[model samples]
Target: MLKPNTLALTVVLALLTALGPLSTDMYLPALPAIAQDLTASAAQTQLTLSLFLFGFAAGQFFYGPISDRVGRKPVLLFGLALFTLASLGCTLAPNIESLIAARFLQALGASGPIVIGRAIVRDLYEGARAGKELSRMASIMGVVPAIAPVLGGLIAPWGGWRMNFVAALLFGAGLATVVALRLPESLARKSAQTLSFLSILRSFRSLLGHRGYRVYVMLSLLAYGGLFAFISGSSFVLQTVYGLGPMAFALSFSFVVVGYIGGTFLAQRLVGPHGLDGTIRIGVACLALGGSLMVVLVASGVASFLAVVGPMALYCMGVGLTMPQAMASALMPFPDRAGTASSLLGICQMSFAAILGIVLGQNLDGSALPLPLTIAATGLMALAVFGLTGRARRG
Candidate 1:
């Protein structure tokens, strides 16, 4: 059943998943120093990360749909080329504004694999295999992001923060070369007149009509929003307010990610027996518990910056637990529109987080408490939406 190709495909998909993390993590350790050098506020520097995510979210819409029409490899190469060039721009950027603008373009290019690769996997496998494959790829990201900040912290001072972008540029080029040489064209030759925008508009309507799809997308958007906000502000909370150095922070930061890894591993086992509904319930419950702890810490005036260590990990675990089920359900009905479907999901996810990130970044207040409280509030909001979506479907 498990062929070598299946394993190879998993590895490739893992590399694709690596793109987002590679973009985010490598620069994390340098945020504080960059802020000082750029003479910008913590919030302003954070905007650079948030803005890149904004581009990452928006880019998915164009690339995903186009890949459906033209096939995966060519579209992938095109995005990678743009990403590589953008990375060069980032490296050579003369100021904070220039770096931020180039980061947006770089994220636009990097988003190619993240948005399209999910659909490509669907093109190759379906049903339970699809969910399993997705989890396998997510596992790589879970592990990689956990360690990336640590690595970034270690290298950033020695190499300069900009070197991180150069590393990302090189990594993208290397991955593109591997894909160019090794990847087969996976899209089946479909000669059907590619659905027009108006027709795809109807497909969107039909997609919303499906109860499972609506629930899944909304849940993923809410869930991922919380994580993005945390990432957006962790530098300020940990390194600046709490006076942590890069290495200490990365090591402490990863402890939270451990919760996510545990939850996803558990979800993989539980999904088969408990079903999507049950797995999501457990994930949300854990998330709610984590969120409540955050609010409690802040309200009680007992908040140490370290209070984040426990809750953030739990929150990320909930995301890992819920992602496979939500992803599987969203993709289940649209084998034909896998690209379109994934693009839609990507749109909701990034848009949701972008709004939340903008709000959180705007409120940094020179204290660590706001960061955790913002994360807690977003987590609470996500749990509420997750519950409502589930109830709406049942009624």
Candidate 2:
């Protein structure tokens, strides 16, 4: 029996959180079109995507502490404004270089809502309850990735890629209006901390020094690396290696989303009873199982699309399970510094994923070996780190 206001707030926060994935996935169908229209190489057009991630990671480091000092509402509104302007810039870019720059700026603007959105959640809840709320939000946010590409595919042909940016612009503006009108300030007590560079550095150092926080953050980074590997390589793997058309590839990608939705639902149900740590263990087990199965399938010469999609879907479910718990756990000890904590978490996840995306992109051959293998390796690393850290803490 959730309150109506609570439910509405969660929905709004979920939408805010979904913006990054929507911005990334929505224009994927237009990559080749963007390249051809701008007279750019495939790699150059791809930079538009990677740079957005880098900007996102970099922007979070700034927004988190600022929000902690100034409150969430102002920061969110500012971000939405920046995001809208950047979206327009993206829509009107004259060339690939301009588009890349606009995309980076767009991500910088988008980072505000994402980092602050999580901080808002931390402001309202804690411990296993926070994990449940996050899982619920994840359930709603999961649909964005599932549908963004399909919408992009439909829209890209109508106006040649720029239409996707227009859609994003409208979305940002609408969301901004919603926030300005209805969203209440969740940061009831703004930190008295200064926004000085040295102060920010000290806060970051303190959080990083916490062994539990470090372990959870590292686990999240590894999980995100695996997820981004899927994102960076999936289009090429499906379209080039498996011969899926644009629409077909988008549909296959939805399998991962479906798995995510299911996993979030499971996490929401289980976290209250099992606790966050137990839920995380279940998630890591799922991740390892899925990743291992995918590697074995690909290694044994089974090249069917279902073979790849099925196991990846399982892996995504694991991601869905792991992230909410990990995020809640990571920020639980930093109630006063939730904004900064959320920011660091976003930076670690996005930076690692961006680096992994570059690595995967560079190593692409005509085979699917690299993607699944990378995913499996990341899963194993996360599990190993989590286990070792837990044992050390107990010892």
Candidate 3:
């Protein structure tokens, strides 16, 4: 849309976006191996990821405002440098505790790009156009995690699991160099807002107080959490319950992402005509339907790996379909406060994801029960929130 060159810019942003999902998914295949190497329990090992997300969420508090104050480019370079170093540290960690610490720092640093990139986009595009551009960026990024586990499975065994960290470091540094050269400052110094801790708190309060933003964040948490629950529990469920090998499990998981892509393709075509509101209602309805089916399947005797995942895939498709409209509508009124607004959205998303993952992990039955129930429950909660919020906004 802006121009054909906009597509090129989206391509770069897509790679920048890849950093977040890449770090999360790439290491998953090696989780069991790392536990064996470090002599840690599954939950303790999971603590690494949890801490990374916590740090990622925490870092957003600082990074968003800093970029808003100074500019997008410098803050990004500084964050990328820190992220690169942290990734290297993760590779050389001597134990699980240290590994967890490095991951926290890594996530802390990664938060800069995630927060700033969105702000940068808000800097460049707005209104409905933002959603289309975001979808374009997401399409490039969305494909990475689909194959990352398979790639990690091959690389970890051949090069030892640490290679994942090393490769990530290299990728980060390369991204940093590209940013240093090509990325112009989108948010001018004059455009930058002075943010105190209290000011940031107020910004967050305002975002939460906004009905549309709150609903969108809730939508993300519930929908994205479903995927992450599957992510966190999949290895255990597939490998432990169904006895699928890591390579096999990774490929199977990759198959689910197709539904996500399909949904996005459909959503993009629908937005210009039906608009955000129509698209989101349709998406939530589909998600609720899929989630209800999953609940019934689990309640009856049909809960197996396929039974659980097949319907959950439909909900994921709804996520891809709805997220653009939901997010765009949320950020629409907060042009000046986009950074703080975006951070709250990220925090809500990750916190919900963390809770869902923990629930699935703690309730591990060496069966698919925990996974499907978790999925259905999250979907149901999201549906309730979506319905209530939709009515509230209309009123």
Candidate 4:
């Protein structure tokens, strides 16, 4: 087998971890066009995103344990095939309902890469090394969110919304081919008890019972929640409320992701001197500050594109700093059961974001308040949770 931490392995891992963002970010610029073309309401179109999150959350729960039992490569290949097929299903979807269902199926498959890719990282490293590696992977994966929507916007005007799914299909196929040819099995030890119901239950209980793991997972969840609120609502808010064209909105979205990319790089630098907890403390402060600024801007009747995406860039930067360290901390304690721990953390993060996406969708009223409000709440909540939990642990 190839040596660990090679550039090739890191690239593959980054691509696998990017599946979630690739699936959502690329199609984001198409949401308005989809609603217009399908004769669906904005709320209905947003269901595609929310349901995708739900499916992603549900799939992570199973993919982790099953991969632990059978090994990572086979399960990952299966998921890639499913995702590729589902993307085709999305491209051929005839109506809004069909598109929604296909998006959900695509998410189910996408979750395998996301959850298992993290497990594979855990397989190879731990603690601050794991945090730095994850930051590297995230830094690489960050390009997808930055570029996918621009590509989608470029394609959507000429090829239409369905063409975005065609791009997704091709991406899935190409990634699958690479994995099949170049990637080795990352699971070092296969657990026979991984899939058993009792074993799964015990694993969950043990992971949840760990204080540090629980706190880290919550921190990750809140960080993601703040970021996702922007993901779910930005296209509409930027397009409808702020009069941005598809390309303009795509560029704006990419600008916000630059903040996230910068954060990942910052995490790499800080993880050594500040450590995971210190990095997180610095990061959440950014999250809270950016989020609060967004709320203030909108509440003060300042509803420009910059007003929204500006603060979001800072918030996303915070996410960049927070996620890798939090993930490394949570999964560090469960080296033997990393897959299970990864899945549980994935589920909590996605489930809450999924529900929050739906809430944002329902509350969207052609105003700029809901998106910023939701982001601010999640950011503030994360800061509060970290403070209280960290104090409790100290006490």
TM-score per prediction, in order, is: 0.93, 0.96, 0.93, 0.97
Residues 1-395, model 1: lDDT tens digits: 22334767777777786788788876887888888888887767887888888898878867767777888889888888889999999888888899899999998898888877887788888776677677777776678778878878877878888888888888889988888888877778542546577765665677788887888888888777778877787877777677788888888777777777787788878877877677778877777777678767755666466577777888888888877777877887888778778878887788888888888888887666666676666667657767777665453
lDDT of 4 at 6: 89
Put down candidate 2 lDDT per residue, 1-395, tens digits, no spaces: 21323888888999999889889888876676788899997567767878888999999998999999999999999999999999999999999999999999999999999999899999998789888988998999999999998888889878879999999999999999999999888887999987987998899999999888888898788877888888877877877788887788888888777998899999988898888878888888878888889999988888688767999898888898899899999999999999999999999999988888878877767788888999999988877877778753332
> How many backbone collisions does model 3 have?
0
Order of models, best lDDT first: 4, 2, 1, 3
Which regions of candidate 4 are displaced past 4 Å? 391-395
As for candidate 2, its clashing pairs are: none
Deviation of model 3 at 335, angstroms: 1.3
- Candidate no. 4 TM-score: 0.97
Q: Which scores greater on lDDT, model 3 or model 4?
A: 4
- The C-alpha lDDT values of all candidates are 0.78, 0.87, 0.77, 0.91
Native-to-model Cα distance after best TM-score fit, residue 315 in candidate 3, in Å: 2.2
For residues 60-135, what per-residue lDDT tens digits would candidate 3 score against the true structure? Answer: 8877766777777888888899899999999999999999999989988888887777777777777777877666
TM accuracy, model 1: 0.93
How accurate locally is residue 225 in candidate 3, as Cα lDDT from 0 to 100? 80
Alpha-carbon deviation at 368 in model 4, angstroms = 0.3
Model 4 C-alpha lDDT per residue in residues 264-329, reported as the tens digit of each score: 999999999988899999899999999999999988998578999999999999999999999998
Candidate 1 residue 179 C-alpha distance from true site, Å: 1.0
Ranking by TM-score: 4, 2, 3, 1
